[model samples]
Target: MSKEDTSLRFRQFEADDAPVVYSFCLQLIFKQSCWQLRKKTMLNRGWMISAVTASVLLAIGLSWPVTLITSLLCTYLLIWISHTAYSYYLRHNRYQDLCSTAAFVARWCSGGQDRLFVATLEDGTVIASSGIVHQDIDTCELVRVATEESYQRKGVGRALMKYVLRQSTSFGYKTVVLKTSDVQTEAQRLYETSGFSLSKIYTVGRGIMTVYYYKLNLTDH
Candidate 1:
């Protein structure tokens, strides 16, 4: 597909789109979950919390002017460090059964929020895929948002996501939510720029992994 073809034709999925969609889903999930990315993001987030506390305590003994400067510096450092750390650690590996969090949309799309969509070229080559699941009457879940490895950052992923958000709004879901890993920084940007807010952060395996939840309000859409 032309990289400049910002108008990639999108439509509902078909039985034949299954294998390719599954391959893209797994590849992105596994590749982004690489330990190298996790280790890089985890660098000293635990330490920054301690540093922030220490700075506040250390300020107790200083002159007023110095104390003010120190507190500001500490707070700035804390926010900066924490943001960097989190930006790296929000990756998710939630793919489970056909109906799991990262459920393969091809075979698992059952209707409601589970409806799936795919992006294709005019010649019928599939290049991207995404889906939404209804968490409840008021909330929808986004999942399996993936693009061919070679197609990353060419505007395909963002198109698929915006499409999903529109679908969520159309289906009566007021909010759309999804979990993503810490290292998926680019994906997070897409979500945030699309009006999704960070709703919560969950850690499992005693901090071995951190998962982030993001939500987009579709009410005003």
Candidate 2:
């Protein structure tokens, strides 16, 4: 094969690698976000144990004294770990800021016909305000809802809730589902007022946050 052809194949391989890396990064960000939100610290003692083993193996191949090389490599590994943790911190924080908004704006902008609805503010500032997420099973299921702190208590959340329910009704979905933290009393009240009935309690990570699932039936619409 020609060198140019080989190079082109290598570039394609690299492009595929980029998406895999992005997916891994996004997964880590999500895990870290949940950990952060729940105040759960991921104890990583095994990484240190594994790093020590790696350093010992590397030092054996080095001409330098084993202690010196092992120490240096171990230090380097620790530094890299710290750097990775800090990068994850920055990435999730930034992503939370960017995605914290009216998700319907995205749907509106994309003219998406899918069950999701998203919206943004007028000033190019993402309202991060209240937003709704829905899934159609036998009916429209309110999968999730989130709103930025600054935009809460003003009915943006209720509006999104109603919007999703209306969309579900139009789509011929019979039910909507959602789960909320028990600590969020106001949110629970809002959901009840919107015609949602409590279903069950769920315990997530750390078992500290109690989540209550609610369902709303769309018979009238």
Per-candidate Cα RMSD to the true structure, in Å, reads 10.0, 16.2
lDDT of each: 0.70, 0.49
After superposition, candidate 2 runs with Cα above 4 Å error: 1-114, 119-137
Tell me the lDDT of model 1 at 92. 27
Weakest ten-residue segment in model 1 by summed lDDT: 91-100
Tens-digit lDDT track of model 2 for 181-220: 6556776898899888898987854454477988877894
How well does model 2 score by local distance difference test? 0.49
- TM-score, structure 2 vs. true: 0.45
Instruction: Give the distance in Å from residue 128's predicted Cα in candidate 1 to where it truly belongs.
Output: 0.8
Q: Candidate 1, residue 175: CA error in Å?
A: 0.8
